[model samples]
Target: MDPRKQRSRDRLYAAALELAAEHPIADLTVTQLAGAAGVHRSTFYEHADSPQALVEAALTAELDVLREELLKDRADAATAVAKVTEAVLRHILIHVDLYRRELADGAGGLHAMLSRHFRGTTETLLERGRIDLDVTVEGMPPARVADAAARFLADGTVGIIDGWLRHPSARVEDFLRVYAALLPSWWPHSPAA
Candidate 1:
């Protein structure tokens, strides 16, 4: 990628995140994001086709950073999984405002997109032996179990998260408790239990 273009995209991503934090995703516009990033309206078009596309790019970039954070300082399989799951929940909590806005607006299947990204990251971890799993998917080959597990967990996780987002009383701890329930044997039970 060209350095200058990369810089512009990076600015746009950062600006999108900032605006997302402050305004509803549906209410945000390309002009607002471009102005926030100190770039021209045409420059944003050079990077993304629409405001939703820009937001998706920003969210994807944030998720990439979170993936790196979760994979750092590798540990046992259970510990690693616990860390990754917790990091995901915490990341969502930190961006709860944006999530609520997007979910309420029906902003283009964000949960599905997140699930896809998570599945890809988890599959990579499994293939690289970063996360060890003893279970196989149905009668499938052991080599492909990682792919299957990733799909199951990623889809399930996103579904649970979307439910929590819709619930008015759901908090970060509530979300974490639901996630932790999936891996009860991984760590000490939470206070909620």
Candidate 2:
């Protein structure tokens, strides 16, 4: 796509996410997004196949932002765990509305968001962490460890976020922090020795 068109789509998705923060995705419409973004309706569709598509795009954009930001934020050995944990915690805090709204209706929104971003990203994080924790982790292959960690984190964390969303006003930080502590416990040495 042309640079100008790419920027327009980016703006439209940005508008869509901003709107989604205040309202449920089900409540949002193309017209509202187009107006908020100052782009034509046709132009909005050029960026995404639908409003949900826009959500997906917006989230994917955030994931890229997070990947760069989190990885660059720190690179030390002992710190990566805390870094990933804190990154996820802070992310949920910032987007609590969006997260809660996603889970309001039996977690349909949660499912969508997972399919959109966290699933693959979780796997990637697991693999990366495993590689980094080589001395602490022993001999597991990166793919297996990554796959397990991804599945474990995605499933359990999604459920926890759903609960937090259901409550809406609760502080989930401590809850997520403890959960983060469990992650490194999976390191092979912790289990074998």
The Cα local distance difference test for each model comes to 0.75, 0.66
What TM-score fits each model? 0.77, 0.73
Model 2 scores what on Cα lDDT?
Answer: 0.66
For 64-90, candidate 2 gives per-residue lDDT tens digits of 676566556545533553555556656
Clashing pairs in 2: none
What is candidate 1's lDDT per residue for 1-193, written digit by digit as tens? 8999999999999898888878766688988899999999999999898887888788887788877766674665556655666777777777887776676544455766788888887777766776567675577898676566778877777777878888877777788777777742313223221
In angstroms, the error of model 1 at 34 is 1.6
Model 1 score (lDDT): 0.75
